[model samples]
Target: MDKERIIHRICALHETCPGNIVTEKEAISPELIGLNIFGEPLVGFASATDELFEAFKNSDIVGPWFLSPTEWLPEAKTVISLFFPYTEAVKSANRKATTHPAAEWLHGRIEGQAYLLKLIESLKKWFDDNDIKTCVPITDQRFEVVVAGNNFKQYSCVTADTFSSNWSERHVAYIAGLGTFGLSKGLITEKGMAGRFISIIVSKELAADPRPYTGIYDHCNRCGACVKRCPAQAISLAEGKDHNLCGAWLSKMGNLFKPRYGCGLCQTGVPCESAIPRKRRT
Candidate 1:
């Protein structure tokens, strides 16, 4: 229906959704069984025809493979971006980790993702019941994600650079006035960088939110806290982030942690961990 109604429904679902809670049957450890992964989500809206979507297709950005909202759904009129910040339990646990990912963070990465899908699926169903058309691009049949060290020819779109996807939730969130990018390449919102982003395109037209700042990295204070927190050494004040190195380190984490691998060290102990950092004076 309207933005207020949409947000209310989402928050209600989050509060009552069993998938949002880590069940004993699925937890990797006893302590994680009752852990809640995400807090109340932040939602933002953007016009499906935003010019920024065209800019994202530039080679230096997401490349030609990046699909705009309308490309995903021809009748798309609004892009609803949702940021689900990790619960305090999840962030606090990960902050205690150094070289490897905390078990709590691992569950957040694996099971938390499953909950995201379920949340969106339920939301989509509600829209369908209301006679509104919606598309969850991440779960769409056309979605394409090229991971590092993986072949891409299997997909119609190919790029020499890996570690990218056709539908980037972060970029979409930025367009929705959700936040800006930090030095770590993580989108820093009012709720912070330690979270997951997902979006849906709908036929319903909604007023687009105004971006409070102009620059892509406006929310980032360039404090370099993420640099010190990075265990993979994948981030720096000068070069920002090296995706290859970050990807390799994640691969190593996969070998060590198996089905639940993740390294959010750059996200947890940073100045923008839970909120936008105040800009430092030069």
Candidate 2:
């Protein structure tokens, strides 16, 4: 299928999917029952043979655990990456809370992810119906994410200082021309940093989009707004983000919020929350 056709299908699904809306059973408040979780998604495609995918195998990047498109789907010809921005209701609610995650934001984190998985599955089925093979690496049975200090011997090569996964949506998004990394390590797209990313590798070959810029942090303005917004002080202009500290905070949030836990303070109330921050006027 053509890029336009794929995008149209995704948009239609986002518009009509019941999972996209917070239902009464899953909502934190009566007013939040119908809150939209994500805005229109931004889709980008990359050739499966892109050199950037190979580069990701390096230690500094995603490590040897990073799986290229071909590794996920042997005949993979294209990699489709999508960024689904959070709706204003979710962002605004999180902005109002300084230290803790708002109930709306928590739902966005939990329920929003549930919707994303369904969207991914739908896209996979679409490709299957088209007679094209596809694989969603993150959802694949082989996928694994090893946290620091975990006794996972097979992944000992991955250091304990950072979050390491067999497949990283943000990294794949960058290769697919979606966006660049922000100070808080969030992918900053034209629609901004507060969002979720999902990708699929398919046998269908689509023209890859041109990456508009060079350098990993080209879009980031180094505004440091995320640093000040982080309740865990996990972000800093001098050091960037500390995933360990951030993970600890999220764990603490689980104790307070239980099954639904998240803290997106660095994502909201920041210059890069909803759009790319403007560079210095001078």
Candidate 1 ranges with C-alpha deviation above 4 Å: 147-160
Candidate 1 structure quality by residue, lDDT tens digits, 102-136? 99899899999999999999989988999889999
lDDT value, residue 171 of candidate 2: 79
Please report, as a residue range, the 10-residue window in candidate 1 with the lowest summed lDDT: 150-159
Distance (Å) between predicted and true CA of 196, model 1? Answer: 0.3
Per residue, candidate 2 scores C-alpha lDDT tens digits across 1-282 of: 699999899898887766989898988879998899899999999999999889777665567777889999999999999999999999999999889999989999999999999988988888899999999998999899855343223212233565688888887888889888887878889999998999999999899998887978888898888898888998888867777789899999999998889999998998888888888665
Error (Å) of candidate 1 at residue 257 is 0.9
> Which prediction has the highest lDDT against the true structure?
1
What are the Cα lDDT values of the candidates? 0.87, 0.86
Q: Give the TM-score of each candidate.
A: 0.94, 0.94
Candidate 2 achieves a global lDDT of 0.86
